[model samples]
Target: MPTFNQAYWEERYKNDQAQWDTGTVTPPIKEYIDQLSDKTKRILVPGAGNGHEFEYLVTQDFKNAVMLDIAKEPLANVAKRLPELDAARLIHADFFEHNATYDLIIEQTFFCALSPELRDAYMTKAHSLLAPGGKIAGLLFDFPLTEQGPPFGGSREEYIALFGNLFKITMLHRAYNSIKPRAERELFFIFEKK
Candidate 1:
């Protein structure tokens, strides 16, 4: 398997090959944010390439939001784009090594970007990082899983099996608001820590 580590990602950024970036906050996540009533809950967006989600959160008056990535380029781009947000909240680090807790941990393309062997580690770390009843909400691809991608795909059943023991699966179905190319290839899910 190809390494999906910092060097691998950083090279992708350096070479401008990040095709996974949608260039804006994804619609389903935006819809999810629109229904949230609390602005004080801590939120984390790991592997936040280009940081559109965190930018949307900050602009919508969410007081505590963090954007993290192993690659510095995207974080630098985010800083330039969101000059008003505190620099301390833009973390450049590995998600596995990150040590902060949050009330909500947002996922985007980060999970699929890792080697499949690390899925359990990702699950365990996500559980550890969240406070009691904390949630993880976002899109996961719903296609065949093959060895050919950072955008690795899986099915709803796999996701349910992966997370059901540690979380309450509040929502997991096809996303109605995905952008054009991703329209039928993703699942919008919310799993609250149990």
Candidate 2:
């Protein structure tokens, strides 16, 4: 199993080879963010490469948003675009080692980028990072699992099985508003920490 480690991901960024980067936040996530009334919610976007969603939160007036990644290039790119956002809010660290809590964690391609062995750890960490009643909302890919991918895939059943122990599955279904390429192949979900 190819562990999606910092070095591996960093090299991909260095080569500008992030095929997963949509260059903009996906439509489904935008819609989800649109419903959020509280701008003070402490939101965390881990593995936030290039930070499209991170910038979106800030532009939407989410004052407590944080963007964290293990690579420097994407973080630097984000800094260049959103110069006014606080440097403290942009973190360059491993998600597993990050020591803070959030009211919400926005997932994009982050979860699917990891090896299967780390899925449970990712669930555990997400549960730990979220405060009581906090939630995680975002897209997860829906396809077969294979060895050759950073953008790996899994089914809704597998995800429900993996996360139901810790989260209340508020929403898990096909994403109707994804970008053209991702439309039918993704699932939009909101899992509230119990």
Predicted model with the maximum lDDT: 2
* TM-score against truth, every candidate: 0.98, 0.98
- Model 1 scores worst on lDDT over the 10 consecutive residues at 1-10
For each candidate, C-alpha RMSD in Å? 0.8, 0.9
Predicted structure 1: clash tally: 0
Tens-digit lDDT track for model 2 on 1-194? 55577888889999989999999988999999999999999999999999999899999999999999998889999999988778999898999999898999999999998887789999999999999999999999999876778777899999999999999999999999889988789999999999
In model 2, which range of ten residues has the least summed lDDT? 1-10
The TM-score of predicted model 2 comes to 0.98
